[model samples]
Target: MTNVQLGAPNFRIVSTNVSGEASSRALFGVSYGLGMAATQFALIPLDDERTLYKAAISALWTRFETENGVAEGRKLALVNVRYDSESINTFFYTKVTTVVVADVVEFE
Candidate 1:
């Protein structure tokens, strides 16, 4: 049997989402693995609340060659935005800050 293992992407990615959905968008990308992000927001008079979100994601070195966005993280998700400061407040509120990028290998 052949032995093979994939190494994690060498990334110090510091992404700041703007107007994307509280729900993650799956776009094909070069990098693939599991991940999560911290989404936060505030109420008029109540304290801030946070939730955890996790999903399969990828980070591409470049955009996908094709238009089909089947693969996750094919491209960074985009949403409506006016100013950079309103990015966090426009989406779902959560504290999911870390996404564990990994692969699932099968033995044959």
Candidate 2:
């Protein structure tokens, strides 16, 4: 149980429960061995969807982390990006992009 300090009105602290269903999903993907990574696409509606964002995300990871500890034959592929729209405030909106990274047995 990790305690996270999220500053608030009363300066309340919250515990991070990774065992919850929400956090559990982050542990795996389509297949146990498949790799994935993701990031937010835009603040404005670039209208980026999962199918379109996959290629960009994959390229970004490879170019930046080609020398990672992964094996020679194992490369990171852009599995998909999760797009979410959140209404944090009445006058403004937030679009969250979650990039998923995974290790692959085969290279494309």
Candidate 3:
């Protein structure tokens, strides 16, 4: 149970309940394996940060699909994704790259 103050005279209350079996194991806790890939953009004019991020993620997923067998229409899923970005500044422009690492999981 909780109370949220929206404004000076407005308020809202919320409540939530959860129940689960003790023997049930969490899905995210189980990691079949992990894969990592990097995408680089050098002297490329990108529309925005969102576009850059999307491109980086797409490249990582494509690598996984091609080499790691995480192809399309598969029951496997990627979770707990982590990534790092690096940029190199030069006299004329900057080169940016991102490395993504994620754990793979398969559904029963």
Per TM-score, the best of the predicted structures is 3
Candidate 3 to truth, TM: 0.47
What Cα-based lDDT does every candidate model obtain?
Answer: 0.26, 0.31, 0.43
What's every prediction's RMSD, in angstroms? 14.6, 18.0, 18.5
Residue-level lDDT tens digits of model 3 in 1-108:
634333563322111111111111111122111223323333444334433446655666666656556456755545566665554545445445555566555443
- The per-candidate count of clashes, in order, stands at 10, 12, 0
Ranking by lDDT: 3, 2, 1
Tell me the tens digit of each residue's lDDT in model 2 across 1-108: 635333644331111111100111111122121123322322344343544235444544554345444333543232223332221222233232333333332233
Q: How does each model score on TM-score?
A: 0.19, 0.26, 0.47
Candidate 1 residue-wise lDDT, 1-108, digit = tens: 633433654322233331111222212211112323343333331322222222212222112213223435432332222221112122333121323232222222
Which one is best on lDDT? 3
Candidate 1 lDDT: 0.26
Q: 1 or 3, which is superior by TM-score?
A: 3
